[model samples]
Target: MPTALTAAYILHTLFAGVWVGAVLLATWKVVPLAKGGDLGPDALRSIESGLTTLTRLAAVVFVATGGHMAATVYGSEGLFGTGRGHLVLTMLTLWFVMTALVEVGGRRMRSALDVGKVRTAARDADAFLKAASVAGLVLLVIGGYLAGPAV
Candidate 1:
């Protein structure tokens, strides 16, 4: 059980980091480049495709590992009755927000790209991507706080 819990934590943290990093990069670098005409539509589409894949993969991993850890650490009681539990709940909410943002942003970008509208796609997706980036950072901070020695 200990080993399994450890593994779960490792996976959860790693996937979260990867997701957040990708969002940050896309929000800060990719979108700007695309908007500025520095990045071609083909390249932007490729990046968006890769980001979508990573986002979906990370979301699945996060849910599985997070559920296991929550079940193990808090049992049923730890869900809503404690401070850590609140943080976990918050993280879960942010996770959903990030996932939705990615989905919507990807859809917007893909549709525009499909029509050969590169700048329009970038403009449409930028806000959602930026919001997701902020949410991802907050999730990481809360996760770190929850992982303190008290746990």
Candidate 2:
């Protein structure tokens, strides 16, 4: 049977995959629409709504699974004990903060979209995407480290 830590690792890996996938999907779909030509008020609003919904769902899954994984893996000592632990904790912190910002920005964009304010919504969405991308990259690095042999 898998240990708690092993289970946590699997859960964390799944959450990270979903989180990164959502961000990339939105970036691919929306960025081109924004750049290709003006998406206009209606199309942009629709895009914003769809992205906001997708992001919120992804965030919920990430937070729930990640919290459980963190508790199992880090426990009382936190993720700061050894070098690997410290690196994991630092990366997690960065991703958490960035994800929070993305949530806030996503909410703002949703509101703007509701009002048919395409430009404002697009701006907020852009900010959210950028932050999410950075978070994803950090997560990827942390995952790579976790997969490597212990020193």
lDDT by candidate, in order shown: 0.92, 0.69
State the lDDT of candidate 1 residue by residue for 62-95, as single tens digits: 8799999999998767888888888889899999
What's the CA RMSD of model 1 in angstroms? 1.4
For candidate 2, lDDT tens digit of each residue in 49-82?
Answer: 6655765775676566666766666664766566
Off by over 4 Å in 1: none
Best by TM-score: 1
lDDT of 2 at 106: 69
RMSD values for the candidates in order, in angstroms, are 1.4, 3.1
User: How high is the lDDT of residue 40 in model 2?
Assistant: 74
Global local distance difference test of model 1: 0.92
- Positional deviation of residue 118's Cα in model 2 after best superposition, in angstroms: 2.5
Q: What is the alpha-carbon lDDT of model 2 when measured against the actual structure?
A: 0.69
